[model samples]
Target chain A: MKFLVFLEHHGDALEKGGLGALGKAAALGEAVGVVLGEGASALAPGAGAFGASKVFASEDPALAPPLPQPRVDALAALVVQESPDAVLFGASVLSADVAAGLAARLEAGLNWDLTDLEVRDGELVGKRPALGDTVMVDVGWTDAPRLALVRSGALDPVESGGGAEVESFEFETSDFSTLATLVEQTQEESTGPSIEDADVIVAGGRGLGAPDKFTLLEELANALGGAVAATRAVVDAGWYPYATQVGQTGKTVSPKLYIAAGISGAIQHKVGMQGSGTIVAINKDPNAPIFDFCDLGVVGDLHEIVPKLTELVRAQRGS
Target chain B: MKIAVCVKQVPDATVHKKIDPATKRLDRFGEAALNPTDLNAVEEALRIKEAAGGEVVLVSLGPEKAVESLRKALAMGADRAVLVADEGAAGSDLLGTSRALAGALERVEADLVLFGQASSDGDGAVLWAAVADRLRRPLISQAASLEVGDGTITGKRQTEHGYDVISAPLPAVVAVSDAINEPRYPSLKGIMGAKTKPQETISLGDVGVDAGAAGEAGAKTTVLELGPPPSRGDSVKIEDDGSAAQKILDYVVERRLL
Candidate 1:
């Protein structure tokens, strides 16, 4: 099967999720990579290590901005030229828009938030979690050039030794596609690793008591060399930035250790972090559903326990 | 400035949602409510109408029961509502659903279209782009803050790294994030008035959609099987005393996580 994976990149660094999708596609069958933006061609060779057999690079000025419409036009043009059997993407804010627009533009079938993809009887099937991750549903496309958006961090990128053939492609952007202009872009000031990349995640919930209480999680996360996350309730309550939200609507993360403090272990929050290697729940409510799934459940007041835990971790690290 | 707000009826957040093994579909017979984020879309549209001096109309596609959810939005100060309810459109996927909704928007000739970033159920968060593509209009998604200007709309959306501010002309599609605004509760007076507001129901044909091109027949994807999620193994529970912190640290050390 010939699969085309959309490799999302910022400058020369390809997003890890896209690389993971590329690696999986390459493992399944012939995988080609499509890169768009100002220096897309420069990033093509790098995809080779991630299992891309060939790369199509587009350096159209219109596609330079991180907007979805222009990238959709470019991908649609490439789809017509290549006509690959399927197109894959690692779900992200920008990639989701591009995939959806491309699906609409090409009138192709699109499956989203998929956790896995496999071949069955020579047909591609997508595995998706539904109903708050209570069940896994097998999904299949009814047409060719099937489009899919894999959940972020669902697949891991593996470096396979090889070089890929890089080819430059040309595409046209419709006038309406360029109508939206980017006025400003700013990065949030943060330290340590992002939740997606952290090995340990210290997540706070309404149990944190207040917005400022998140600093306790920060201290714990810092002691453990981890990142801080928040439950949807706290984020929606404006106790934390939306970027740190961990739930159905926010980003899914799988870390080595997930420390949920004051979290009730709701189904929504569980779906996002259930994949963690070890889950530790610290809440005053012994009956919090999170304890049912957590590897280690602690019934206590987090405000006191978190600070004490941070001290122990720091002492253990001898820092 | 006529605005069209697309909304959905989802299983209540507290509900333990399940899929019927026979039909492989979400059993929607339980209690349901308007998707929480969609309320944000309705609220945003109402705000725009209050400022721009035009009507805010809600549009939805679902079983006939969905009108109850629409009424809730109507009670929030929307002028009217249109629901596309037909057996033929029962299992419509993103494409088919967008086609039907786009047709309704076309009929409305809305100056702006709004949607929640995604439904809590499907959570694909891409339907707005599809509708916008079908309408051949620009789309600005994940809008945390939106401003309707003379002929353009400026939306600020939070991104992974930070946020981006984007501008698109009128007659655009926008999907607002939950961070945008607080949805207002329907007052008793508004709830009573909503019953008199026009609530129209149409079919796939009325929206110029071929019946064969909607619902399950029009869906481009299908479910092959269903199973429970992988289980996490045995867990150990402990009551926190003075030593709870030390026990956790020991567990971490035992696993060599440190």
Candidate 2:
């Protein structure tokens, strides 16, 4: 089986999720990497270590700003040429657009929210979560060049210690494709590591009491040298930024150690952080479902418990 | 100007959700409500209609019950609604839904189309782009703000990096994010007025989509298995004694996590 994986990158470095897709695809079969952006061609060699046998790069000034239209045009052109059995993508804002556009352009089927992939009887199958992730459904594509969009942070990138050949493609985009212009791009300023990259994460839920109480989580996360995340309840309540939300509807994370404070451990929140190596729940409600799945359960008030925990961790660090 | 908004009926997440052991599908038993984010799309469309002097129409493709969601949109002040109810659409994936919805939009002759960034259930966030692609129209997704004018539709899309201000022509597709605007609740007068509003039902065939190309037969992907995720393993419960924090710290230290 042959697969094509889209490598999302900013400048010369590729996103870790894309590398994960490449790694998965390479494990299944021959995996080719497709990179589209301003300096897309320069990213081919790095794609090799991630298991890409060959890299297809499309570098056009018009494709700058990483908008989806030009990317659709570019990927559509490449897919028509390569005709791989399946196309896979790692989740991101731009990847979502390009994947949808490609599926529409090719008149092919796109299956999304997938967490795993496998080849069965010479056909590709994807695994996705349904019913608030209470069930994991096996999904398969009905057509060739089947498209699959994996959820972000679902796969881990592995190095094969191999090299890949790089190929550059030049294509013409339709005038209509270039209609949308990206005015500007700003990065949200963050203090510590992002949830996606943080090895340790401290997440809070409505149990945090108020937005101001989030400081307790912040202090605890800081003392542990980890990032802070929030449940959908707090994010929906505007107690925290949407970026820090961890749930079925928010970002999926798999930190080595996840500390959920004041979270009820709803299924929605559980699905997002279930992949953590060790889960610690601190909630006053002993009946919170989070305790059922957590590695450690602490029945207590977060406001009282979190500060004490932070002080202890700080003291231990100083020791 | 004419605008069409796509809406979906999803099981409210606040309630208990179940999956059928036999079929391995989300049991459609229980309260079904309009997708919350789609309410933002309806509100955004209504605002555009109020500003641009146009009609807002609602389109949905699902079981007959999905019309309940369309009716809710009508109650929110959409001029009309179209329901594409067919058994053939039962197991359709995002692509099939897009094809069916795009066909319905073509019949409505929509100048602009809108959808929520993603449904709370599927959370795919890729449907509108597929629809826009099928219709050969430009797409602006995850819009935080939107405006329609002089044969062009512009929107601001939120990204992890920041935001992107994007503009497309009048015949474009836009997906609004929850950040776009606060969705308005249906007022008493609007709910009563919605009772008399026009609602039409169309089939997949009526919209030029073949039944064989949708639902289970036409689904690009099929579900092979359904089961709960793995357990998180044995948990070490900690009682809230005065020394609970010290115990946690000790555990953290033992794990070398600090």
Which pairs of residues collide in candidate 1?
none
Q: Is the docking of candidate 1 incorrect, acceptable, medium or high quality?
A: medium
Interface RMSD of 1: 1.4
Interface RMSD of 2: 2.3
Q: What TM-score would every model get versus the actual structure?
A: 0.95, 0.92
lDDT of 1 by residue, A195-244 (tens): 87688999999998899999999999999999999998998888887788
Candidate closest to the true structure, highest DockQ: 1
Regions of candidate 1 where Cα sits further than 4 Å from its true position:
A311-319, B253-258
Say which candidate scores most in TM-score.
Answer: 1
RMSD of 2: 2.6
* Model 2 C-alpha lDDT versus the unseen true structure: 0.84
Candidate 1 C-alpha error for residue A97, in Å: 1.2
lDDT tens digits by residue: candidate 2, A88-132: 999877899999888878877888878889988988889887765
